[model samples]
Target: MSPPTAPSWSLVPDDLLTEFLSLLPVKSLLRFKC
Candidate 1:
């Protein structure tokens, strides 16, 4: 039998996720698809 997979980070709360991402540089943010 296979082991269980880990949960995805995409499940993070919007407000918290945005707040954390905001701390990153603008250039770095642009690198992500958003």
Candidate 2:
């Protein structure tokens, strides 16, 4: 049997995602990068 695939974030638009990320503080962004 094949393994299940991970969910994708393709539903979200790139511009919207970029705006959301920009609103986050540097510390929060750093934490997510790890």
TM-score of every candidate: 0.38, 0.46
Off by over 4 Å in 2: 1-8, 26-34
Q: Note the residue pairs that clash in candidate 1.
A: none
Every candidate's lDDT: 0.72, 0.76
Task: Write candidate 2's Cα lDDT for 1-34 as tens digits.
Answer: 6754633655778899898788788769789999
RMSD of each: 7.4, 7.0
Q: For residue 26, what is the lDDT in candidate 2?
A: 76
Output candidate 2 Cα RMSD.
7.0
The best candidate in terms of TM-score: 2
- TM-score (C-alpha) between model 2 and the true structure: 0.46
Candidate 1 residue-wise lDDT at 18 = 89
